[model samples]
Target: MPHIHVRHYPRNFTEEQLRAIDEAVTAAVTSTFATGEDTVSISLEPVTPEDWDSQVLAEIAARRDELIKAPGYWNES
Candidate 1:
Protein backbone atom coordinates (compact mmCIF):
# COMPACT_ATOMS: atom_id res chain seq x y z
CA MET A 1 0.00 0.00 0.00
CA PRO A 2 1.21 3.48 -0.81
CA HIS A 3 0.64 6.15 1.83
CA ILE A 4 0.45 9.87 1.13
CA HIS A 5 0.44 12.49 3.84
CA VAL A 6 -0.90 15.93 3.12
CA ARG A 7 -0.54 18.73 5.62
CA HIS A 8 -2.37 22.02 5.32
CA TYR A 9 -2.93 25.12 7.34
CA PRO A 10 -6.36 25.31 8.99
CA ARG A 11 -7.41 28.86 8.40
CA ASN A 12 -7.57 29.36 4.66
CA PHE A 13 -8.42 26.03 3.05
CA THR A 14 -11.84 25.43 1.55
CA GLU A 15 -13.74 22.37 0.43
CA GLU A 16 -12.82 22.96 -3.17
CA GLN A 17 -9.16 23.18 -2.24
CA LEU A 18 -9.38 19.93 -0.31
CA ARG A 19 -11.14 18.23 -3.19
CA ALA A 20 -8.50 19.46 -5.59
CA ILE A 21 -5.75 18.15 -3.36
CA ASP A 22 -7.39 14.76 -3.14
CA GLU A 23 -7.82 14.63 -6.87
CA ALA A 24 -4.25 15.64 -7.44
CA VAL A 25 -2.98 12.99 -5.07
CA THR A 26 -5.05 10.36 -6.80
CA ALA A 27 -3.85 11.48 -10.18
CA ALA A 28 -0.24 11.56 -9.10
CA VAL A 29 -0.31 8.06 -7.69
CA THR A 30 -2.14 6.68 -10.69
CA SER A 31 0.23 8.32 -13.13
CA THR A 32 3.59 7.90 -11.45
CA PHE A 33 3.23 4.68 -9.48
CA ALA A 34 0.88 2.83 -11.83
CA THR A 35 -1.50 2.36 -8.94
CA GLY A 36 -5.26 2.62 -8.88
CA GLU A 37 -6.85 5.40 -6.87
CA ASP A 38 -8.46 2.87 -4.55
CA THR A 39 -5.07 1.57 -3.49
CA VAL A 40 -3.64 4.98 -2.67
CA SER A 41 -4.14 5.96 0.94
CA ILE A 42 -4.18 9.61 1.94
CA SER A 43 -4.03 11.25 5.33
CA LEU A 44 -4.77 14.93 5.72
CA GLU A 45 -3.77 16.87 8.78
CA PRO A 46 -4.62 20.45 9.61
CA VAL A 47 -2.80 22.36 12.29
CA THR A 48 -4.51 24.90 14.52
CA PRO A 49 -3.83 28.53 13.63
CA GLU A 50 -2.53 29.46 17.06
CA ASP A 51 -0.30 26.42 17.37
CA TRP A 52 1.07 26.33 13.84
CA ASP A 53 3.18 29.47 13.79
CA SER A 54 4.27 28.95 17.38
CA GLN A 55 5.35 25.41 16.62
CA VAL A 56 7.36 26.58 13.63
CA LEU A 57 8.95 29.37 15.66
CA ALA A 58 9.86 27.00 18.44
CA GLU A 59 11.50 24.59 16.00
CA ILE A 60 13.48 27.42 14.44
CA ALA A 61 14.53 28.74 17.85
CA ALA A 62 15.59 25.30 18.99
CA ARG A 63 17.78 24.96 15.91
CA ARG A 64 18.92 28.59 15.80
CA ASP A 65 22.26 28.16 17.50
CA GLU A 66 23.26 25.27 15.27
CA LEU A 67 21.96 27.10 12.22
CA ILE A 68 24.02 30.15 13.00
CA LYS A 69 27.18 28.37 14.11
CA ALA A 70 27.43 25.55 11.60
CA PRO A 71 26.26 25.95 8.06
CA GLY A 72 27.11 22.31 7.40
CA TYR A 73 24.37 21.18 9.75
CA TRP A 74 21.80 22.61 7.37
CA ASN A 75 23.54 22.06 4.07
CA GLU A 76 24.62 18.45 4.48
CA SER A 77 23.82 16.15 1.58
Candidate 2:
Protein backbone atom coordinates (compact mmCIF):
# COMPACT_ATOMS: atom_id res chain seq x y z
CA MET A 1 0.00 0.00 0.00
CA PRO A 2 1.33 3.40 -0.99
CA HIS A 3 -0.16 6.65 0.31
CA ILE A 4 0.89 10.04 -1.06
CA HIS A 5 -0.17 13.40 0.33
CA VAL A 6 0.35 16.61 -1.61
CA ARG A 7 -0.01 20.01 0.04
CA HIS A 8 0.07 23.28 -1.87
CA TYR A 9 -1.19 26.84 -1.78
CA PRO A 10 -4.62 27.31 -3.35
CA ARG A 11 -3.86 30.31 -5.48
CA ASN A 12 -5.84 29.68 -8.65
CA PHE A 13 -5.55 26.16 -9.93
CA THR A 14 -8.43 25.04 -12.07
CA GLU A 15 -10.16 21.67 -11.70
CA GLU A 16 -8.31 20.34 -14.71
CA GLN A 17 -4.99 21.40 -13.23
CA LEU A 18 -5.70 19.65 -9.97
CA ARG A 19 -6.74 16.51 -11.78
CA ALA A 20 -3.57 16.62 -13.79
CA ILE A 21 -1.54 16.94 -10.64
CA ASP A 22 -3.29 13.95 -9.16
CA GLU A 23 -2.64 11.88 -12.25
CA ALA A 24 1.02 12.87 -12.45
CA VAL A 25 1.66 12.29 -8.76
CA THR A 26 -0.03 8.94 -8.85
CA ALA A 27 1.97 7.94 -11.90
CA ALA A 28 5.23 8.96 -10.27
CA VAL A 29 4.51 7.05 -7.11
CA THR A 30 3.37 3.98 -8.99
CA SER A 31 6.41 4.05 -11.25
CA THR A 32 8.88 4.56 -8.42
CA PHE A 33 7.50 1.84 -6.20
CA ALA A 34 6.33 -0.52 -8.93
CA THR A 35 2.86 -0.63 -7.45
CA GLY A 36 -0.50 -0.99 -9.11
CA GLU A 37 -2.59 2.14 -9.46
CA ASP A 38 -5.40 0.47 -7.56
CA THR A 39 -3.15 -0.07 -4.56
CA VAL A 40 -1.95 3.53 -4.40
CA SER A 41 -3.77 6.39 -2.68
CA ILE A 42 -3.28 10.12 -3.10
CA SER A 43 -4.62 13.09 -1.19
CA LEU A 44 -4.24 16.76 -2.02
CA GLU A 45 -4.45 19.43 0.66
CA PRO A 46 -4.65 23.16 0.01
CA VAL A 47 -3.18 25.37 2.69
CA THR A 48 -3.11 29.12 2.83
CA PRO A 49 0.23 30.89 2.75
CA GLU A 50 -0.51 32.68 6.00
CA ASP A 51 -0.95 29.41 7.91
CA TRP A 52 1.80 27.50 6.09
CA ASP A 53 4.39 28.29 8.75
CA SER A 54 2.22 26.96 11.53
CA GLN A 55 0.43 24.12 9.76
CA VAL A 56 2.90 22.73 7.22
CA LEU A 57 6.36 24.17 7.83
CA ALA A 58 6.38 23.36 11.51
CA GLU A 59 5.49 19.73 10.93
CA ILE A 60 8.04 19.40 8.16
CA ALA A 61 10.76 20.94 10.29
CA ALA A 62 10.03 18.48 13.07
CA ARG A 63 10.34 15.54 10.70
CA ARG A 64 12.82 17.00 8.24
CA ASP A 65 15.16 14.03 8.25
CA GLU A 66 12.33 11.62 7.60
CA LEU A 67 11.14 13.35 4.46
CA ILE A 68 12.38 11.54 1.39
CA LYS A 69 11.60 14.47 -0.89
CA ALA A 70 11.59 17.92 0.64
CA PRO A 71 10.79 20.96 -1.46
CA GLY A 72 13.80 23.16 -2.23
CA TYR A 73 11.88 26.41 -1.85
CA TRP A 74 11.11 25.70 1.80
CA ASN A 75 14.72 24.84 2.58
CA GLU A 76 16.08 28.25 1.51
CA SER A 77 17.12 30.36 4.49
Candidate 3:
Protein backbone atom coordinates (compact mmCIF):
# COMPACT_ATOMS: atom_id res chain seq x y z
CA MET A 1 0.00 0.00 0.00
CA PRO A 2 1.15 3.51 -0.79
CA HIS A 3 0.07 6.25 1.58
CA ILE A 4 0.55 9.95 0.88
CA HIS A 5 0.02 12.86 3.23
CA VAL A 6 -0.13 16.44 1.99
CA ARG A 7 -0.13 19.37 4.38
CA HIS A 8 -1.00 22.88 3.31
CA TYR A 9 -2.44 26.16 4.54
CA PRO A 10 -6.20 26.27 4.97
CA ARG A 11 -8.44 28.03 2.39
CA ASN A 12 -5.60 28.19 -0.11
CA PHE A 13 -7.14 25.63 -2.48
CA THR A 14 -10.60 25.03 -3.83
CA GLU A 15 -12.37 21.65 -3.99
CA GLU A 16 -11.43 21.19 -7.61
CA GLN A 17 -7.83 22.04 -6.85
CA LEU A 18 -7.75 19.58 -4.00
CA ARG A 19 -9.22 16.91 -6.19
CA ALA A 20 -6.58 17.59 -8.80
CA ILE A 21 -3.94 17.43 -6.12
CA ASP A 22 -5.27 14.10 -4.95
CA GLU A 23 -5.23 12.71 -8.47
CA ALA A 24 -1.71 13.96 -9.12
CA VAL A 25 -0.43 12.60 -5.84
CA THR A 26 -2.02 9.24 -6.52
CA ALA A 27 -0.43 9.12 -9.94
CA ALA A 28 2.97 10.01 -8.55
CA VAL A 29 2.88 7.45 -5.80
CA THR A 30 1.51 4.73 -8.03
CA SER A 31 4.15 5.36 -10.71
CA THR A 32 7.06 5.76 -8.32
CA PHE A 33 6.29 2.71 -6.20
CA ALA A 34 4.72 0.50 -8.85
CA THR A 35 1.50 0.37 -6.90
CA GLY A 36 -2.06 0.36 -8.21
CA GLU A 37 -3.98 3.61 -7.95
CA ASP A 38 -6.69 1.75 -6.06
CA THR A 39 -4.20 0.78 -3.42
CA VAL A 40 -2.89 4.26 -2.88
CA SER A 41 -4.26 6.44 -0.12
CA ILE A 42 -3.95 10.22 0.08
CA SER A 43 -4.73 12.52 2.99
CA LEU A 44 -4.86 16.29 2.85
CA GLU A 45 -4.19 18.14 6.05
CA PRO A 46 -5.08 21.80 6.32
CA VAL A 47 -3.21 23.92 8.82
CA THR A 48 -3.33 27.60 9.52
CA PRO A 49 -0.49 29.75 8.14
CA GLU A 50 0.38 30.91 11.63
CA ASP A 51 0.88 27.29 12.70
CA TRP A 52 2.77 26.22 9.58
CA ASP A 53 6.19 26.69 11.14
CA SER A 54 5.51 24.72 14.30
CA GLN A 55 3.04 22.25 12.77
CA VAL A 56 4.66 21.40 9.45
CA LEU A 57 7.99 23.11 8.72
CA ALA A 58 9.53 22.15 12.01
CA GLU A 59 8.72 18.50 11.57
CA ILE A 60 9.98 18.44 8.01
CA ALA A 61 13.17 20.26 8.97
CA ALA A 62 13.79 17.79 11.73
CA ARG A 63 13.51 14.94 9.25
CA ARG A 64 14.77 16.66 6.14
CA ASP A 65 17.22 13.99 5.19
CA GLU A 66 14.55 11.31 5.38
CA LEU A 67 12.13 13.08 3.07
CA ILE A 68 11.92 11.65 -0.43
CA LYS A 69 10.72 15.00 -1.77
CA ALA A 70 11.75 17.98 0.31
CA PRO A 71 10.32 21.44 -0.43
CA GLY A 72 12.69 23.60 -2.48
CA TYR A 73 11.68 26.72 -0.56
CA TRP A 74 13.25 25.25 2.55
CA ASN A 75 16.49 24.40 0.76
CA GLU A 76 17.75 27.95 0.30
CA SER A 77 20.99 28.66 2.11
Candidate 4:
Protein backbone atom coordinates (compact mmCIF):
# COMPACT_ATOMS: atom_id res chain seq x y z
CA MET A 1 0.00 0.00 0.00
CA PRO A 2 2.93 2.33 -0.55
CA HIS A 3 1.96 4.82 -3.23
CA ILE A 4 4.56 7.50 -3.91
CA HIS A 5 3.61 10.91 -5.20
CA VAL A 6 6.25 13.44 -6.18
CA ARG A 7 5.39 17.10 -6.82
CA HIS A 8 8.01 19.13 -8.57
CA TYR A 9 8.51 22.14 -10.83
CA PRO A 10 7.40 21.71 -14.41
CA ARG A 11 9.74 19.97 -16.79
CA ASN A 12 9.63 17.65 -19.76
CA PHE A 13 11.31 14.39 -18.87
CA THR A 14 12.26 11.86 -21.50
CA GLU A 15 11.07 8.27 -21.26
CA GLU A 16 14.42 7.13 -19.94
CA GLN A 17 14.28 9.70 -17.14
CA LEU A 18 10.76 8.66 -16.23
CA ARG A 19 11.68 5.00 -16.21
CA ALA A 20 14.73 5.67 -14.08
CA ILE A 21 12.67 7.59 -11.57
CA ASP A 22 10.05 4.86 -11.36
CA GLU A 23 12.68 2.19 -10.87
CA ALA A 24 14.57 4.19 -8.29
CA VAL A 25 11.45 5.06 -6.36
CA THR A 26 10.22 1.53 -6.48
CA ALA A 27 13.48 0.23 -5.12
CA ALA A 28 13.55 2.76 -2.29
CA VAL A 29 9.92 2.17 -1.35
CA THR A 30 10.37 -1.57 -1.40
CA SER A 31 13.47 -1.39 0.77
CA THR A 32 11.88 0.97 3.28
CA PHE A 33 8.50 -0.71 3.63
CA ALA A 34 9.68 -4.25 3.03
CA THR A 35 6.97 -4.52 0.39
CA GLY A 36 6.97 -6.29 -2.92
CA GLU A 37 7.65 -4.43 -6.17
CA ASP A 38 4.21 -5.35 -7.48
CA THR A 39 2.44 -3.50 -4.66
CA VAL A 40 4.06 -0.09 -5.20
CA SER A 41 2.93 2.78 -7.41
CA ILE A 42 4.50 6.12 -8.28
CA SER A 43 3.12 9.33 -9.78
CA LEU A 44 4.63 12.73 -10.48
CA GLU A 45 2.77 16.02 -10.65
CA PRO A 46 4.00 19.31 -12.03
CA VAL A 47 3.63 22.26 -9.68
CA THR A 48 4.65 25.68 -10.87
CA PRO A 49 6.51 28.01 -8.52
CA GLU A 50 3.59 30.43 -8.64
CA ASP A 51 1.31 27.88 -7.02
CA TRP A 52 3.84 26.27 -4.69
CA ASP A 53 2.80 28.19 -1.62
CA SER A 54 -0.93 27.76 -1.95
CA GLN A 55 -0.72 24.15 -3.06
CA VAL A 56 2.45 22.34 -2.03
CA LEU A 57 3.31 24.33 1.06
CA ALA A 58 -0.23 24.18 2.30
CA GLU A 59 -0.22 20.44 1.84
CA ILE A 60 3.10 19.96 3.64
CA ALA A 61 1.93 22.10 6.50
CA ALA A 62 -1.35 20.26 6.74
CA ARG A 63 0.39 16.92 6.74
CA ARG A 64 3.41 17.89 8.82
CA ASP A 65 2.82 15.34 11.50
CA GLU A 66 2.56 12.52 9.02
CA LEU A 67 5.67 13.45 7.06
CA ILE A 68 8.29 10.72 7.27
CA LYS A 69 11.02 13.26 6.56
CA ALA A 70 10.51 17.03 6.65
CA PRO A 71 12.05 19.19 3.99
CA GLY A 72 14.77 21.72 4.83
CA TYR A 73 12.84 24.59 3.21
CA TRP A 74 9.48 26.23 3.96
CA ASN A 75 8.26 28.13 6.97
CA GLU A 76 5.15 29.82 8.31
CA SER A 77 4.26 32.90 6.28
Q: Write the per-residue lDDT of candidate 3 for residues 1-77, one digit (tens) a residue.
A: 87777788876678899789888888888888988989998887889999998889899988878887878788534
Per-candidate clash tally: 0, 0, 0, 0
Q: Which 10-residue window of candidate 2 scores lowest in summed lDDT?
A: 68-77
Q: How should the candidates be ordered by lDDT, best one leading?
A: 4, 2, 3, 1
Q: Alpha-carbon error at 27 in model 3, in Å?
A: 1.4
Candidate 2: stretches off by over 4 Å? 75-77
* TM-score for each candidate, following the candidate numbering: 0.54, 0.78, 0.79, 0.88
Error of 3 at 43 (Å): 0.7
Per-residue lDDT of model 4, residues 3-57, tens digit only: 9889999999999999999999999999999999999999999999999989998
| Worst window of 10 by summed lDDT in candidate 4 | 68-77
Candidate 3 or 4, higher lDDT? 4
Q: Give a tens-digit lDDT track for model 1, residues 9-45.
A: 7656688987898898889888998978889888877
Candidate 2 lands at a TM-score of 0.78
Q: Model 1: runs farther than 4 Å from truth?
A: 48-77
What C-alpha lDDT, on a 0 to 100 scale, does residue 16 get in candidate 4? Answer: 100
The residue-level lDDT of candidate 3 at 30 comes to: 88
Candidate 2: tens digits of C-alpha lDDT, residues 1-77? 89988788976779998789878988998999998889888777889999999999999988988988787778645
lDDT of 2: 0.85
